[model samples]
Target: MDTEEKSNQLELETALNNQTLYWQANLKLLVKLLVVWFAVSFGCGIILVDWLDQFTIAGFKLGFWFAQQGAIYVFVALIFVYARQMKILDRQFDVGDDDSNQEPQS
Candidate 1:
């Protein structure tokens, strides 16, 4: 019932809200990246291969290239993209382990 206690409770509530929002954002980013990964790896590589095969690239069928190589490249690129995005997300959430700039604890 004291003013200090009420202020502390409000600060805790705000922090919890911010943490929840950060997690929600992180999950949404993860889902979106997974969807793109699935679409490239499975959709283009398998389900739509027949349609894509009608085109040719460097003496290889587009569908075959996608099924064999293009998807792998995309997956690798996605890994780097995810890492970069997560770094930014970590900064946004005040997480991760770059501690040189932090104040020393007593």
Candidate 2:
């Protein structure tokens, strides 16, 4: 291949590699967040209910709280956490919004 063609090919490979890495990181974050959500919602709310019920929080059984309110609260928190983390990830991967790159108005 000519020098220019080889350069373009190298750039394409680098871009593909970066895209793969970005997706891997995104999936890793998603899986971790989902695990935390599952652990709190299912594990604490169901499987460990008996064990957690032994404790009280604000006069409510811990397990009951998880089953009733805690899971919803945790899910909401996770939404915000996901947004924030994705923002950071986008910035790290150079995939964030680029207003400056937009075409100028006619």
Candidate 3:
């Protein structure tokens, strides 16, 4: 192969590797957040409800709070967390909302 062809092939391989790494990082973050949501919503709300009920929060049982309100609140918080984390990840991967890389429109 010519030098230019070899150079293009190397660039392609590098881009593919970077894409794979970015995807793996994204999935890792997703799995971690999901596990936290599952533990709060299912583990605290249902599986350990009886145990958690022994505790109180603002005149409500902890388990009931998880089932009724806490889980929803946590999920919302997780949404923001995901957004912020993804923003950081995007910056890290040089992938999103980067106006500096764009040409000015006429």
How many residue pairs clash (N, CA or C atoms closer than 3 angstroms) in each of the candidate models, in the order given?
Answer: 0, 0, 0
lDDT of 3 at 48: 93
Write model 1 residue lDDT over 26-85, tens digit each, in one string: 898899889989988799989999999999999989989999999999999888988898
Candidate 1 weakest lDDT stretch, 10 residues: 97-106
- The candidate that wins on lDDT is 2
Candidate 3 least-lDDT 10 residues: 97-106
RMSD in Å for all candidates:
2.9, 3.7, 3.5
TM-score list, all predictions: 0.86, 0.88, 0.88
Give the alpha carbon lDDT tens digit for every residue of 1-106 in model 2: 5999999999778877877998999999999999999999899999999999999999999999999999999999999999999888877877667574332222
Per-residue lDDT, model 2, residue 61, is: 99
lDDT of each: 0.84, 0.88, 0.88
lDDT at 44, model 3 = 95
Question: Which clashing pairs does model 2 show?
Answer: none
Model 3: CA > 4 A from native: 102-106
Position 5, candidate 1: lDDT: 100
